[model samples]
Target: MGVDFDWVILGILAAFIAYSLLTKAVDRSLLTLPIIFMGVGYLVSDPLRAAAPPEILSEGKRLLAEFTLVLVLFADASHVRFSQLKQNWQLPGRMLLIGLPLSLIFGTLAVYLISPEGGIAMALLTAALLSPTDAALGQAVVSSPDVPERLSETINVESGLNDGLVLPVVLLGAILASAGVSDANTDGLAIAALIQIVLGPLAGIAVGWSVARLLDLAQTRQLIAESAEGVVFVATAFAAYVFAEVIGGNGFIAAFVGGMVFGNTYRHHIRFIREFMDGAGQLLTMTSFLVFGALLLPDGIEHATASAVIIAVLFLTVVRMAAIWLSLLGTGLKIKEKLFLGWFGPRGLASILFTLIIMDEYVFANADELLACVSMTVAFSILAHGLSSTPLARRIGKT
Candidate 1:
């Protein structure tokens, strides 16, 4: 019943090649890259389990999840133009500032009442984990010509920024959950988190600016190969993340801020950098989803209870929609537009990464149930959002 690692690699290779060929067609249909890979992973989970030990598999998952998130945050943030952001920051700003906090509050309340097994700390933790939206999940809509530019940009920007913005909250949640919020040194934790947040961006700026200057000198002196820029670019991301972590800062935030600084500073080379990173990112993303389906999803599904399922449903729909709708009140968007924005807040990579972080770092009385709820929400989001994206993007494009 054992599957060899060679066979597993071959299978993944074949699946990726086939998917690449059918990518355009798949994009046109309701099926998505995540759905496809997740299914493939689920189907092969048993065989893979026979091949790898639990600890090895867990470590593999952690590395894959972390690297995937690092690249994603970096790439996404790099694409955001500061000038454009300044011009259109209103919509995303409101969502991040007003909508995000409301979502956290509402999500915590919902979890507290609906899934009381985890207590308030777990409730807050879960809420913080799920609050950030995933741009990868909404790629269809954001990239679609049919969707309004402003709308797509708003969603894109929100996704790019919110994960970094909320990382502290997630850290706080874990600290509080471990110590029990009442017994925890809440003030000290807050100060520590605040310091990490501040230091992350500072490290990012230093890495980004230094790297950009080096690249500029190299290019000017014709000392570096065009092909090698990609290597440097990827290295910069890792460097920013590692440097930040070394300085007791949040790596993800450093990656994001580094990307922003890199993108802005290395303007002439952005296209080359993105071309290389995008291909790599796509591969990492697909592999991460595959691992998720094979391991995380199964575990979550197995441990999920009735309350977990209920909370999952509410978090995706009621909690998300209400927070979005309320945040856009004075923006004068039509009901359909508001709903469109609300509905597309799909949970994917960030949530998955946060769940992994919880599994690794935190000890919750209701850890299994907490992850189950988040996992269920992510699964539902993958299907619901994937199926709806293309058609909805088309529908909204006409309006």
Candidate 2:
């Protein structure tokens, strides 16, 4: 495993320019940045892998993926305005509350049925890991003028919040999968999980509230420069994650909770956070996909099984669609609207990050099969959702 720094750097630059130049065309068509970057990485994986240090390839990619997720989680959470959501909260609320759990249940059952040998833990781990949706994968649908405001906002909010909501279950599944491999004590794991859940939010609140206050006072006194706000935004996210981790709590949860607090409390400065996400956040996300193609996807495909592909198909289609459809049953949305919402739940960045976490931090007896299933699902999503988003959104808008 080699890290081709020059190729990676040069490719990123070229892809950035190319994508930027044709941004409108790509948005209007069935193409997305993730698709292009991932395809490029896949096409040149051999050369990229051949030219790098093995250690850096392994650890560096994992860290890059993790930090990307942390930033995404925080930024996404910070964008939510609770006050504005008061009017249209029911749709996303139902999806997060009802649909998310149902997707996990359906996905778990499907994985378990397909690979009974992997056991309930493995099935649960796979299900939980794939539960979160990445709206960026289908940005055209979410950002399209053709899409109704209610529909687009619902999708955006659901995607923004679901990843953080599912992080605990993902972590629990990881622990259980690890325990299955190593005879870890169930009671101790239970205790640790409880503490993690409780303490993570506490740390987040502390960091977020404190930072919000500091920023507020600074702004009031005209002490902090406007240009420095972006730096503060990112630093706050890292502070929350690291603070939680140092205290044995969940870093991801802390980052999200902290972001929620910071965003809501310091609502006036939210623009800076958005700007950071638009630039740094987008770069990190695209880099993750490229790294996935060059590194993770190859190994996942190599370990792919017939059962893995089947599970991936089921997760993307039946599990997700059914969950969304059922959750929106009483919302008075038409059949077409429900189906449209159901189909766009593309699994991308969050799934990739969760899979990378499982690969880096835990040992699973069924690691290869598990990873292959996740990779295939994300790859399928990039194509299926990315291509369908523009056309479907336009069709829905017309209706």
lDDT tens digits, residues 143-166, model 1? 999998999989998998888777
**Overall lDDT per candidate, in order of appearance:** 0.86, 0.88
Worst 10 residues of 2 by lDDT: 181-190
Alpha carbon RMSD to native, model 1? 2.3
Report the number of the highest-lDDT candidate. 2
Superposition error at 134 for model 2 (Å): 0.5
Alpha-carbon shift of residue 56 in model 2 (angstroms): 0.7
lDDT of 2 by residue, 1-399 (tens): 556579766876797788878887976666788898788778767877777778978888889977888889889998888888787889999999999999999999999988999899889999998889999998989989999998899899999999999999998888888888854455587788888898999999999989998999999999999999999988999999999989988889999999888888884647888888788787787788888788878988999989989998998889999999999998999999998888889999999998888678877889999889988999989989888888898899999
Off by over 4 Å in 1: 181-194
